[model samples]
Target: MQIPIINRSRHPLPAYQTEHAAGLDVHANLAEPVTLKPLQRALIPTGLFMAIPVGYEMQVRPRSGLAYKHGISIVNSPGTIDADYRGELKVLLVNLSETDFVVQDGERIAQLVVARHETIAWEPAEELSETARGAGGYGSTGMQ
Candidate 1:
């Protein structure tokens, strides 16, 4: 699937590192490094604009290495970029570690995954169909 993108920053366009990678790596477009103290959050920009297709969205996700090694992660987890949005791609990053971390210009701060989505039509009813494990979630099932 080919998507149209505008690169306004000095860095190259984001791309998938591996052939089978689901998400493409996105970078920061800051002129200088931004420091995030403990428990701090910031909206980092990518300096790139995209024309996402209808019925699909761009999901901004966290990098596993940053989360595991530095306790840095995206606050919204999978941030959504709707199809109609025509703005720079920004990431909401948070520092979960005790120490501060510096984000450099053109740094791979997050990953963008393109996914197809659907709109639902609600069929209101008095009562819903029953199931054995209805409404059970968040570890409701036994752990092995």
Candidate 2:
């Protein structure tokens, strides 16, 4: 399936992949030096917009490199992008580490994954079936 992408700027950006069942990487370009103090939140622009198909959603996830190296991560990791939303894609980043994080323009900040979901009808049930580890919560799986 072909996905429409809008490049408002004069410069042409790399093509957005719609065939592959993978996430699209978003970049943040920091022309000047700026710091994101610990626990500080900021809106990072990706300079891109997309036309996503209906019945599908895009999940915004953080890049491992950015999280591990700079302690910068998506405030709402795996943020959902509804298909009907026709607006500029923005990244909300938060600095977790106790240091100022420098973000450069064109830096890969996060990834957008298109996913499919199923809506099910709910029918009230009297009870659920019993299991070997019934009602076991959290560490019920046992520590590795």
Most lDDT-accurate candidate: 1
* Clash counts for the predictions, in order: 0, 6
**Candidate 1 lDDT for residue 67:** 93
Candidate 1 lDDT score at position 102 = 98
Best model per TM-score: 1
Per-residue CA lDDT of model 1 for 1-144, tens digit only, reads 889999999998988899999988989999889999999999998899999999999999999888999988999989999999999999999999999999999889999999999999999899989987778889977644
TM-scores, one per candidate = 0.95, 0.80
Weakest 10 consecutive residues of candidate 1 by summed lDDT: 135-144
> Model 2 misses residue 28 by how many Å?
2.0
Which residues of candidate 1, in runs, are more than 4 Å off?
Answer: none
